[model samples]
Target: MISSNTAQPMKDIYLPEPADVLKASPMTALEMFFEFRLASGRELGHMPGQFVEVSIPGIGEAPISISSSPTQKGSFQMVVRKVGNVSGAMHALSAGRQVGIRGPFGTHFPVDGEMKGKDILFICGGIGLVPVRSAINYVLDHRDDYGHVTILFGTKTPADRLFTDEMQRWASAKDVTFMETVDRGDDAWKGNVGVITTLIPKVRLDPARTVAVVCGPPIMYKFVILELDKVGLKADRMYVSLERHMKCGVGKCGHCQVNGLYACQDGAVFKYSDIASVREAI
Candidate 1:
């Protein structure tokens, strides 16, 4: 039997390729974020749902999801939660701070020819919306290139919501549908109050043709997937992003291993089918 915890050593890990910090700012006290513009002015050439590794000297690096869409040129943004050593140092940084970066890694959502003319459903939870934001924005920017779009987002509470300004605009867009929920409601919160799964039932979707992308804390995956399946969306039609402690941005690092597959290289973005057999992927 395969050892579920067998992992590679860090000495074998590969370093991330470098990029420049073009901009940085505070989204919240716990969140210090930045946008990196590749030196070549070339697109990261990534599909939605990929990530990059950002580093501050001496503090090390961590895998952060690319929160900006591939369709948006010039730069890509990553929002880091100030929770640990590396992230705390990142939060103390300022604009034009030089940092190490590598990637544009992981499999991406199938947004090209296959998704065209089909409805798309995005169900994001808390900070999970950060990664999903890329795809949502891409679809929105190229609105005419696809069919109906619905975004159902939920967070812990009103103050914890990310990208409020952009979310408001998305909700009001002529061609998009948006609704939000807070697990615990505050007096100022007028939106739905409950688990995000509760909002799934109200969504109008042709499950056979609709593509659903859901991301959140690992514990939230199972319940959300069950809700999507209840709507008749096939497991293969659903995609989810999995998070792991990653030391290397490339596959060489064993930190992100899920059995034989490396979350850094093989996933971070995966179809339900791709990881369905991988025991720890949920």
Candidate 2:
């Protein structure tokens, strides 16, 4: 028999770890904000733009993007929309409830890597804001590490806004430029009303130093890329998080394959220039 000290530990990649819900609250009619802490008391080491597989015993498991920044200590967060069985079950969970978490998988935004010293322009539409928020907060926490910060958010309606309180705080921050719009407005809405691409032309930045991050509904990508190109932002300088049916957090499952690349293993976040040649990527 091998000595216990010398034997390598075998870890099961498919087994889920237990995590306790620290807080659960509604962000919108269909979306719920969940904060969880690993039962083992360790931080969920993850980077911005990565996703985790959240599972509820008998229901199912779904890949949800990690919404909180790594700078946030103790616990991690996810904004879950009640779109299916697993997410519906997740909505019923509250603080103290325990669930299974598989991974913080996929490639992440280069926040501390290539992004250092460069200006960040965040363009998010609808639920797309969830993943990008991680990078946004990371930049804010280490504000001095980067150049300027610009955030543009657009949703279907004013009532559909997520993180209203945080949006106000971001807008009020000294060095950050925050702008929001809605496709349609209500009687109380006073901000810009149009698709998110319209806001791109209004902001001024040096294309040489600016890195644009875009995430939103599937239809939003092509139009947003066009708008960014018109504003002098090169495809190489832009990054996007593509939405796919990622069944397994690891690449073994072929569910999230786009062309020859696996969204789960290769990327959920990819440089526009790199994936531009892949027909299904955009």
Candidate 3:
């Protein structure tokens, strides 16, 4: 329904359009980043947090988040963690390979709506940073539009981190406060050590006008929500992305159902107030 991307919108939700792989960079042993330019030669016109269904002609299809912002024109980015057959096939792609794309599906972070004029607190653990980074960078690109911003990142170990170069820039910047820690540290490590939730209480922010966006592993959600509440953030002020078994991204199937709602149709990005009633939604 949203079309900031100038490229052609999907003519058929079940039929995928061609998108070429311009580059593929390894982020970790299992995760890799791919930059795509639609065969239509149009921008993906995707919003932060929206996902696209990537199809490998003979292999199959998988849904991946748009890691880059529409603010960065021309193309979009996706970081895929290879945990199955489809993702493994994606990891095998090179610079010139072509893949099928179906969407910029589901709801997204409200970059132009509730997010405007508000301070932002981002909590990302491990691969969860993929979508969180999209919102963070959009706020950074238009720095003057928002108030104070804070970023907290957690990794399993010192060696498992992603985007080391950009991480350093965020750490050193005066405008944005960035904090990081690892679950376990080695002899070479000297920094905060513990769960991601440990870093949440130390930072102070104005919860009245702040929006906390969180994404990571499923288990991390409830604890993060508990911590955000401790900091005085109201239930409605917190937004979370729920991962589900996605099949029909357009809601025709009920694969990603939470409560009476379909995650694909109703939301994958929901206000805590909207989904708190569902015990499994966190």
**Top candidate when judged by lDDT against the true structure:** 2
What tens digits encode model 1's per-residue C-alpha lDDT throughout 1-282? 977876875552345545678777888767756888776567777778888777777888777899998878888888889888888888777766677766777877777755677788988988899989998998888888878899999988788888989998999998788989999998888889999999999998998778888889898899999898898988888888889987776777588898888887788878887787889899
Per-model TM-score versus the true fold? 0.90, 0.97, 0.94
The positional error of residue 71 in candidate 3, measured at the CA in angstroms, is 0.7
Top-down lDDT ranking: 2, 3, 1
Tally clashing residue pairs in candidate 2: 0
Whole-model lDDT per candidate? 0.83, 0.94, 0.87
Model 3 clash pairs are 5-45
Better of 1 and 2 by lDDT: 2
In candidate 2, what are the lDDT values of residues 162-209, reduced to their tens digit?
999999999998789999999999999999999999899989988999
Ranking by TM-score: 2, 3, 1
Report the candidate with higher TM-score, 2 versus 3: 2
Candidate 3, position 268, lDDT: 76
